[model samples]
Target: MRTTRRWWVPAVAVAVIAAVLPVTPATAQPVSAGPGPVVADGVTQPVFGYADAIRERIFVTSDVDTDADGALDVVAMDIIRPRASEQGLRVPVVMDASPYFSTVCRGNDSECKADLDGDGLNDRWPLFYDNYFVPRGYAVILLDMIGTNNSTGCPVTGGRADNISAPTGIDWLNGRRKGVDAEGNEVVADWHNGRTGMIGKSYDGTLANAAAATGVDGLTTIVPISAISNWYDYSRSNGLVTRANNYSGSLANNVTNPDRRQYCAPVRTQLGQGGDDATGDYNDFWAERDYLPHAGQVKASVFVVHGINDDNVRADHFSKWWYALAEQNVTRKLWLTGTGHIDPFDFRRAEWVRTLHRWFDFWLHGIDNGIMREPAVDVERLPDVWETHADWPLPGSRPTQVFLRPGTDGGPGGLSVRSGPGNRSATFRDTPTMSQATAIRHPSDSSANTENRLVFLSAPLTAPLHISGTPIVRIKASVDGTDTSFAGLLVDYGTRERFSTSGDGIQTRSTEDCWGEAATFGGYAEEGCYRQTVKTVASNPQELVTKGVVDGLNLDSLFVSTPLVPGAKYGVDVPLMPEDYVFETGHQIGVVLLGSYSGYSSRAKQTRSQITVHFDSTRITLPVVGGRQAAVAAGLG
Candidate 1:
């Protein structure tokens, strides 16, 4: 579902066409054929161009009389124009079909192709032709939707049903006739009057946010990385279904098996199971293909790139699309990573392709540059830090509640920090404490049994406490076992000495569901009983509004990176992962807890074990900002 492949190929290999495209010359800005009224069906077969190589060509079309059916029927694209010195820009088109396994298959040892600037590195779109589509300038229009290299049709499986292939590639790039510019020139503004934007990651970024929620025409913006808004939560979490990884085996091999005429029949009826009403609760057909009630009909402007140890699209599905695009105010740009399922081949894919080339060069080439004046959120921290935030629970932050006493030396540096709701904690079936290192069980154990993890500190900063935002932990927990899952950590321990490393290498953080959820008698939602909810944020200032010129290379002093030498005492070690989650002394900061589900493990095991526990009365709210106007947004007043 979102992998680079590690093993498992029961079936899924049939996508070839290879080469036959060459005609390129429709390039934007042309579509005024006035003096009459022909709104809809007017494009029977105009556009052409398919060099496929020699500086790329793409821009194709179809219809040997679509319904007249003389038999031609096809379409193709791969545009990307603009930047010819930029003036009144208007340009912002990006389609990208992605899905080329190379003739029934052959590539992966590391290169299955399609590398659109993710920079694990691979290019061929406009040159060698592996074509993941990236001419970069900002006006791309690819569409091999299913026919492959030559471009025809038949391979569907996208969302919003009806044989979805991203709404037939967004209805042929905004209903035809005008989009070509890889040197064949053409762009005064046509691809539906310019201003379009959509980038993909997994299944073309899950149909570029359901084709911008069908608001249609000139989309305006969408990012969708490591996607899935809901296909039973993209293969169950609380309901269960996980079938052994690789995102449910690429939804079962490159999308269900449609061989036959070599690929088509709506490609296995647009990717298996769309019938008998596939239910799992959250209704309305998953509310019209769940991208969060169409995040307010998306009309563009949305960026959500994820990978918080993505065990296949589970960073809580990017915090459920960032709280449904912040409850429909929309305006979002978030890129969080800890690697584990694409989108972070280190250097966070060149800081996420420069925040996708300056957010499509300022909303599809409007280019005042300021990139919407940056700072909406940008977090990449672990054993290292880079922080930015203006929004995202940063407005007057104050959740403050901390407690977890119960460590008569059982580990966690002799734990003890008393305050509330106590019972001398330890009840998820208490039986932990004994670690040398071990937890990956299927039927094996080498003696690394440890639990009772609880660490909390906060009292050495009369001046340097910044904590950018969102880090909760309210464990009152209890479980005779009916289904429970936990994982939470947010370490910082400032001065104890040992500087250097301030974010982006991630020291300790394991994410797949993170915190528990389905125990429903109506208890344990947020305040203890396993309530460790820190929905993605190591340092987020709304990605510096919108990527603040590549997040201005953060690390803005903190005694120039932890130099408190004065009475010294800054600490924040949440450590929970002990079923074999090692990174060792990268200055300690780990969080790896599994058994996923809620209230206490019922059947959430992605293999990796280290049982034994008894930690009661654990509470951690921590939204805290503290005085001097909270270090005045880190400028230190």
Candidate 2:
């Protein structure tokens, strides 16, 4: 059913022919063109010869004029391909289109650079794609997204202009759009086979997700690492604003060219208005940036990777996107890690490269590598421990409801199915300044700000408890104010030092491991390696498993808010961050209920409100697999 191409043989011969071919001053000689020795991986010794790879620049036109200019904006692409491409050897393309190219430094050293000439080309490209992929018979294109680097436009953040920029480049590569060189000479991607794969991290990866959602031709696959599927989800969660006022405009200003600020002032003002920090409701602006609505249009297969504990992009972005893609029956695979905001290349280097190699080879080069036949999900259970499953959420996980009730002698509280009187309640004041650590620590001690939160704890587990999916917390409560914030945290209370993967998990730079065909290249050398990392360990007696927040006013809907009637009870469901974690025996599962989370919401000191939770009506449901059996065997169910 599948066909494989032996592109390697011809790929090697093209390198040899490059030696006799004439080259211009702008391009380097084909290293493979000269007679060397073939390496172990077949083809030529060093594959495409990284040292003699051809480097050039081109501009691809975008669909929007972000700066209000009459002409459409254009994105700048810096290309590094095997010299054999110039000798009539067609190769597939791997691209990373990012606005952070000139601003954020990538890799362990944090080395970032700007354009050498004013011609929209960088002297030093970030990351190791040029050094690694180019030598493997692929053309690596480092793109400067429109409005950043040497591109002609204003950065619109995740607006319409930003969403379509990268896809425009793919269109140009496939002959649907036009491109030009630095000298304004019309350029065409004749040397490429028109097959492309996009890969990147954070904003770079976000661009890939957006571009793939457009269903652009020639895009065979996309690898989005910790990428955002919806800009609205990035800035807000269930009606709760995560950043200060005008978050979008501030971000736009950070990426836009300083010289074009005056021209893009109106656009920035529009961004600020659309964001509407005063009322964190979903608007048309957010709708335009949401890729989930367009996920059905995606024609390319997807390989997604994300950190389960990453609060930066957060797991919600990936979880929701993955669900949508699944509904569309899209071919997909996932790697769910425990690190925060990190690339797999840094945490799981060897395996990441090997897996990526096969992924790209199968999709771009039509290699029958059987990558598509492997398990669809690879999840990290603990530090450096991984398991593969046929699908996510494990297969047979069931929602187990853990009810909440008052504790004896007026202690913190108790979590079980036993119901109590309906009128019994737990009261706490809205404290917006309390940290998550303080909220979970000494929860039974009423002396330490007990008035700010309500802590509910389950009995110590007799056996291991495994939670595999999103946990939902339902509460029946009434607030004293028209609007208030509600935060629910699922905590693991134990003394052992488990892998601290929440937030930016502890990472230390240590030894490096290199890959690829060779190490030396002229005066420039390429070592496709990064520092080894270890998860930060903590003995603090507790770990925040997952948390969720919501604005009381937006409980009914995210697009609109209805002020709550004071003292009138209302039921609200809060979905905690998805997780794949196991709680060992002797550990207690604790639920911390609070009014505010300063780290994830705007800081506004308002009149504190007294919130009351009906004891018998509140419950936390967890996706438990064989939990009842374990709990029963442990004598705790």
Candidate 3:
């Protein structure tokens, strides 16, 4: 794939405040207001777009009872339905509470609650709701879930135990005369009408996941974007406890200061943070109420999307659900890019809108538009390259392993795989080499505690190997201290620069169940622990760090995820942590020996902790492909 360089232009996040000015007695709560011919404003804004025609004024009905008392004695909503068509009917609904009425919507910035787009019309709730749900030719239903703005009651973001509002929303639609189906059936009149699909980003995405998990009647499809599926993984990656960035405790601060305590109280209760409780596991109360468990049970199809470089929620979430869905044999699609959390600025907004319209048309309209038949995975690699794979990891990739070995020459000595378990180790001088830009360990050396790295190489491959999938690095190691940390890096030896070809998807292969589904290529048979899938070999240099971890006197194997390239020679480099460590007088640094890839390196960057790993037995695990093995499987010569 050819890479192109494009400057990233992030959209400015404008804070929109609500228009909470007191209504004059002259133009108070309306009795009857006709649909007006509202003209567009001259100003153009970043997020707000122009529509061919605006439904100007909606004569919505509303009720309000001012009190902190636990009584939702109010109702308000605008009706926006598509004109009945000769072919099919479409309906959509949008909802938001306070900000649409009061100035403090979503905690900060009253402008966000007003006419955010500067369209000369207030659409705080309208546009935000339609951004995700209302496609062309669909009837729209907007509800004041808790009846905040013009309505009354506790506006449920998605729903509540006592008030499963999402299904209630569907109920409202089917009850409308215009929403009835062919058999003279009021679509929303019955609770058993077809399921309702909920879609949105950020707050809306989380609610969709919650509604889907609740298994509410008439709740069919929910598309949760940039949301946390497993609360534990969301708070903890691998097994390490992460800073509580996405939880209620961190977010409650944003709500409290603004006196939006109305929204805060219910959200905190739902998160279980206010009740001296812990919402920890995937099986816990919060997850039960919100988490979409088995991908197989997703009765409603989901088009999961996420930004790879999201500082808020992280893109690892996409991997979690994508693998789960694949395991459940469910067909789902993913759109992954390197962008900020709130806005997917990776692609133009129009492209995103078009894709969603096509998706909604196929599933909601029953148009047989063949959108579902598209590729399962679409990824945007860095620099710039958008690719579509029939399936993740692409197809026809073969497995090839490059052993990490100690070497006297700058090049890593080529190591080979054996029929049974085997081990080897090598040592290199502690000194800095190569440009600082490509160095794995920083600050080269500190005091007499010298730090050094090794570079091992693999013999050139004879064939054009396709290595588009994931590969594993196995290293057996032991350390001299009570604690140690190991890290791995794959490098290309053919080019003088020793660049790394390990792309976005390549990762350390620990348990085979990494992908869950059994891949036909990799000779490594499937097991319950398998979690990921790897592809074949390419014609570039390759290398892998078999292990990187910190522990005492442990004989374990580590797996490093690094793909390989054919023809060009490959190599491995393992640097002692002291090379990157700042030795504090009393603290001692020790190299850790390992046989497997460690998650220690992954979190070390986040936690800013020092770690070192010493390697003892390092070997390569190659999936035998095409030779005798392929012939035996296919009965070919």
Candidate 4:
């Protein structure tokens, strides 16, 4: 074991928007078309040489000292830029800040930061940013999240140390801060063209969100893939402890450099205590990690990406963040892929690179690319099918309401558009022993349903059913105890192929697709390239579209808990993640109610108290295309 748990790393998006006009470069240096990138055909040309691109390391001091060590912590910034930067040519930057540079890796290929020649410097940058973008006049920087790798400080999960560390690189680039070489000699980013773009997946992406939320100057754009906007949402669901207690601390300790682990032990203790898993209430700790509150301050143009099938980070992270950015009317674009926690570089490949290139050029290089003029999103409906939508919630989309009706003697219920067969109630006891996999397994089979879960299925759809945007499920139920947990799952029942989680949908060929600057170690290929995933036929009868869970007492307030009156009816809301799916003809939409869900959150504890569903008014609101009429026409009734 290199360290603890499944070590994570970072993702990089879809669609190419052709430039609206070919203009002179006007990015960092304010010269024509700016810096040294050769512009042709509305995009930056790869005319710069990758072999001699200047590669070096520097330490950018951060504003935080999590350990109370008096001195500010310094983050490790590894750089690889076009050699033109060393001369009079300046360039914009694309940076990814991640903790996995030390212990974990990224993507399906398990790629990590490497020192190919062991020169104590990163020779082989993870992914293809350095290999592909360095030659295109973009300085690709990989920052070692403070407290990990060669950076100084303690990893505080998403606290100031983690959230505020990486942006120092931006600060240095913009002349807001000064960096130093290994020997402590002052180093200034005089070569930096003022504009910068941050890109990453998972925790790496979370940092980008944090950086943008700060409204930091010079950070003109960000491409956050499968990222988090709120730390509390990552650990809890509707004020219920879904992840294990002390997860914040555990994760902090997991990513910290081994040498400094002991020094940061106290900080880890505080992080765990601050999470307040016992009550699972939002507190100062989670507030510090949340970026949404600061969304109003963001000035960067966001190019956000998320995996619709991703269960690890979940789709809610993107949905909430998207809405927040939208409310602020911030310039933004989105990409929803069918892959689970996978990068577009691996899933979409060439298109991702091209669109990302255009996005950086548009935002960072001040290019007149019509990327913003293009559809706001490129959404993947299937492995081979992608659609470009003008924006989220395709036009005429609205929340369609659906209700649960009684079944034949506790077998399974039917979902109906007609409401108020009122006063009819369905009941089920809490089954803590049932795993989430078993609870939601194969909804088409009646054997999968028991007293542990209440399954409701809609009629076969006569027309196509398209669901986009966030869906909300509110349960009108009563429980036996003062507090209990509930789970609601939205299911798609039909035979179709979807993104496979267990690699059954992909086959590794003997031939490998090589990439990067072609640097190799003693025997290993350190060019950040490998032959990984390929699409294969994968099908299933039923798939989990989304799920939401909540604690009864915390439904109204995540920061406070209210004990329930025995056998009293109350509306318990389960915040389902966002989704973009199209249910074909003959497919049925299903909803499952459970006492808890281990499938969604592995550590979610089951509520042992009995729970009941009052069929009178409980309903789920789906963002279905064409609203109620389309839902009725599609058999969503």
Residue-pair clashes per candidate: 57, 2, 81, 6
lDDT tens string, model 3, 214-297? 444444445566765655444433222234433444443342334445555655554444212221222333333335464555
Pairs of residues at least 3 apart in sequence or in different chains that clash in candidate 4: 11-201, 24-33, 25-32, 25-33, 25-34, 28-194
Deviating ranges (above 4 Å) for candidate 3: 1-79, 83-111, 115-122, 125-135, 140-195, 217-220, 244-247, 255-257, 262-292, 338-346, 381-384, 397-402, 407-637
lDDT for each residue of candidate 2 in 1-637, tens digit (9 for 90 to 100): 0011111123343343334222211122233333222234422224677766777788888878877769988888888778778766677789998887666656655645445444444456567676677787888888888888778888777887777878888777777777888888988776776678999999889999999888877777899999999999899888888877888888877776667677777888888998888888998888988999998998777899999989889999998888888777777788999788988887787799879887877667655555666777899887778999777777666677778776555477877654566778878898888777788898678654347888888788877888788899999999888888887999988987666754366576678656654444323345555567666755768888999988887998888978889999989898998998888899988998888767556653354788889876798888886655554554345
Decide which is better by lDDT, 1 or 2: 2
The list of candidate 4 runs beyond 4 A from truth reads 1-35, 114-120, 441-450, 504-510, 519-528
State which candidate has the highest TM-score.
Answer: 4
Stretches > 4 Å off in candidate 1: 1-196, 199-202, 206-222, 225-257, 260-302, 305-362, 367-389, 393-401, 405-425, 430-603, 606-621, 624-637
TM-scores vs. true structure, each candidate: 0.31, 0.89, 0.53, 0.91
RMSD for each of the candidates: 21.6, 6.3, 17.4, 6.4
- The TM-score, computed over Cα atoms with residue i paired to residue i, of candidate 4 is 0.91
lDDT of each: 0.39, 0.77, 0.36, 0.78
- Model 3 sits at a Cα RMSD from the real structure of 17.4
Best of the candidates, lDDT: 4
Whichever of 1 and 3 has more lDDT, that candidate is 1
